[model samples]
Target: MRPWTLIVVSALVLAGCTTTTSGLMARSNDTEVKVNNRNLGRDLSLSGLNRAMVGGRLQARAELTSKASGDLYLQYRFVFFDATGKALESATDGWQQLNLAGGERRQISALALTGEAVEFEVAVRRIVDE
Candidate 1:
């Protein structure tokens, strides 16, 4: 095979390995939660997130701040996971709405419905207006 052809083939093979995996991946306790702010203003950001055991159940709190010149609408949810990395089934864990004015900061919190939750992840996304 030509040298250039061999290099191109190897590059294609390596690129295929970068595809997303469907299986569960191990996550560390120090992993930072990712928030999708694409549709929101650039001045909005997630400041902090903290998780703790409250009343024998998992409790999560997230702080959001908006430095924009207007109000920002968004949605957030808490996904609880057990020690084995399985997500806990709970009907109450649904997307909740949030509104933040310019230069405003707000803290949102959620409690696990059961004691089986050992870890939690918070996801935030901008609410697109129709």
Candidate 2:
């Protein structure tokens, strides 16, 4: 194995690992949202978030609004975190789908499966068809 060949192989592997996933990300403390898709980002927005502790679990209600004049098909998922900002659950059942009518506002809520969750992040993405 040559040194240059090894370096090139390592670079390729590192590049592949750094690939980013595009979506809309919102946190409990931030009013600003990160949108990775231009069309979806422009039409959809996160309006508000309400959090509470219920039954020893973290409960979150996220308000989503559509500014577009047409309906939007989207999916969203809630990621739970503990006081240290470590994710509490993974391998979720996949994103939950929803429909937002033009100029419509809706609230979606989720309860954490574990009591250790004290923080949460919401990820919303457009549903794409093959």
Candidate 3:
């Protein structure tokens, strides 16, 4: 094998050793929750998403719980969409950090930045310590 081939193979192996977990997504219009990461699905639970129009803007609230026995560090972000399903915000809403105690349940809420936002999805992910 050539030296270039050996280097490429080593890089591929290193990349394969790393694991990437996508955030869990829950849609306001859907009852089913989408789990992108199985590990996080086992540790965290997200449900009871409710949305209401307040002062001509959309407000959303949801229940978040930590099933783990220890403290769980996590992050969440809300993506708002219009009636046609087009995203209103350019996904610029940054991830907000959250910490939950063992078996703790909390109500998380977010208000749509724009009144045109008619639908929404919330994504939650674990904060991996490197």
Arrange candidates by TM-score, descending: 3, 2, 1
Residue 82 displacement (Å), model 1: 0.4
Q: Between candidates 2 and 3, name the one with more favorable lDDT.
A: 3
Question: Against the correct fold, how does model 1 do in TM-score?
Answer: 0.69
Error of 3 at 54 (Å): 1.4
For model 1, how does the per-residue alpha-carbon lDDT over 52-94 read when each residue is reduced to its tens digit?
8888998877777786988877777777889998998654577
- What are the runs in model 3 whose C-alpha is more than 4 Å off? 1-21, 90-92
Looking at candidate 1, what is the lDDT of residue 92? 54
Pairwise TM-score winner, candidates 1 and 2: 2
Q: What is the lDDT of candidate 1?
A: 0.70
Candidate 3 residue pairs in clash (backbone atoms < 3 Å): none
In the range 1-130, model 3's lDDT, one tens digit per residue, is 6999999999999987875437688899999999989988998999999999988989888899889999989998888899899987733488889999999999988888788998888899888788
Clashes of 3: 0
| lDDT of residue 93 for candidate 1 | 76
